[model samples]
Target: MTVKRHDGRKADEIRPMTAKVGVVPNADGSAMFSFGKTVAIAAVYGPRHLHPQFMQNPSTGILRVNYDLLSFSVAERKKPGPSRRSKEISKVTEWALAPAVNLEEFPNTVVDVEIYILQADASTRVAGINAAAMALAHAGIPMKTLVSAVAAGKLDKELIVDVDKEEEDFREGEGATDFPAAKLSGRDEFSLLQLDGKIQPELVPKALEMISSACEKVYEVQKKALKDFIENPEGGNGK
Candidate 1:
């Protein structure tokens, strides 16, 4: 196992995290979350009636997520607006938070979540998920529990809690395995799991254990941000 990370974090340690709510006053609800240098902002609009009458769900309200990585967010700037990658991640994010939300009470309606990466080092999608989860709650959506997420995997021969850009680019030893996962904070339930690299089957359990633990820490931060916003809606930017 590698003894030290390039940024000096222990294998199981995460970079400092920052979370806040009410970042966008115009939106019904909004939040921002960052993992070290990677930052994401999310805004929630609606519970409004579904348009296009044919598409409305009588059984429950539907969630529509639009995720985007700003053109200047990375060194290799992407084209502006939604791309295939953003669309796919948006769908995965919807699936991640859907289970925690109780939408039956608002059938035939829609909840739109807009997420943008203001800056990205690595783990942008997971950061977007974290921000979006808080925005949903701030919008007054009833939820069973908050959802938290992280990208945890193997960095060479070592296990890591949260993968950063340097670790993501590692091309030595066993290489890197980027596994982004999400879970409901108050329960032992996984909401999403996507692996971008290979790993031995025997190591799966250990990786999952690490991911679960990291998410709890993320959840604590998310929970605190929400409570802080409730107590003092005018302010809540924290680390």
Candidate 2:
């Protein structure tokens, strides 16, 4: 099986990433991210009130994430209903972002992180995760670790990084399962893991390795955005 490559990039190459903070005024803080053809936005709201019954811990603040895909993000228009996929993503997002926030200070309040995918090519979840981290940091949310996500897939027996939609289809086929592939499967190492096709256990480690490298690159972008936000309270461009 022959695999197509993007711009001759290496198997672990991440797309050009950019993060911008304070894009939304309504929210306490916000960030936008561009990962190749993928686009994601994240907004943070409140250490505000939470229903008494829903409170998980009165000693710490709550972390919640809401994820949504725009109707026009893909070829098909998505319905305006909650999807299990989004729920799963939200859960992982909350986990990945939780570590960064010092929830103990807020007690009964809750912080909400909202993620919207405007465009998706591949690695939308990872992009969304990264965006959420940036938004929280922009909001001055105290966190321990800066989390990020990315994916690796096998195409025609070749393990490639940042698999786009076309490559994803090829990787999902019956024969694709036999090839080596990897994914981010931990909240500590990665924010989320979702796989539609098959992957060998050995490949899982490789995927984590690639994801670690990618996350560092993304973290740099996040730091830059947060730094700019602080330096130029007016605008990143200093307008």
Candidate 3:
């Protein structure tokens, strides 16, 4: 018998999603994305000068991402300032997004992406990546394509897409398998793939297959947000 999701969604179904662009006026570009209760906002500041000349890469502009989960985002307040996990996820976000951005044109410069979670249920990093990708495009940064990301894995014996905090805390035998991934739009290639927990080796392909479809859904929302913002720079609401 197949197991049922706690939220009554089909194993392959994701929660309600929202996307918006041009939310921060002072920023060169900014956007927000949410997967159910997890909301992430991203601001892009530059393809500007890189200070400390020695650190500049003369051949390519670097992508720097800072991901912060606000102290108030969760029920238990986190300490103010960057934690070890936040720092790690920042790098992960950069790598997940670098493939789609064309940075070589702005050599010796840096594009800084700041992502903050206004609320956290789970899969916050994936939400951040979705927002950051739109923010970069909103900033007028050149790009090969936008990126879309999602978390897919198994809750106990059932395969699922877009795991929530409840699924993340599942502690049955073999527990939860959390797989977060990002992909360039319209491509089968994955730019980011991170795994937590366990899954059968044979099931890897199935999970990837599931994630690809999920990313497509994400890409559509991102494209719409960008298009709406362009048509009306009045700042579109999350759709």
Best by lDDT: 3
For candidate 3, write residues 127-186 as lDDT tens digits: 999999999999999999999999997877778999999999999988999999999989
- Global lDDT of each model? 0.90, 0.72, 0.92
Question: Is candidate 2 or 3 superior in lDDT?
Answer: 3
Over 4 Å off, model 2: 1-3, 171-188, 236-239
Stretches off by above 4 angstroms in model 1 are 236-239
**Which residue pairs show collisions in model 3?**
none
Clash counts for the predictions, in order: 0, 2, 0
Query: Which is the winner by lDDT between candidate 1 and candidate 2?
Result: 1
The pairs that clash in candidate 2 are 100-143, 100-144
Error of 1 at 162 (Å): 1.2
lDDT of 2 by residue, 1-239 (tens): 44556456677677788889888877887888887898999999977787665675779989889988988898889886669988877887777667557989888888889999999886787788878887887777777766666666666556666666666666334434211111222333444555656667777677667666666677778788888888887885331
> Where is model 2 poorest over a 10-residue stretch in terms of lDDT?
177-186
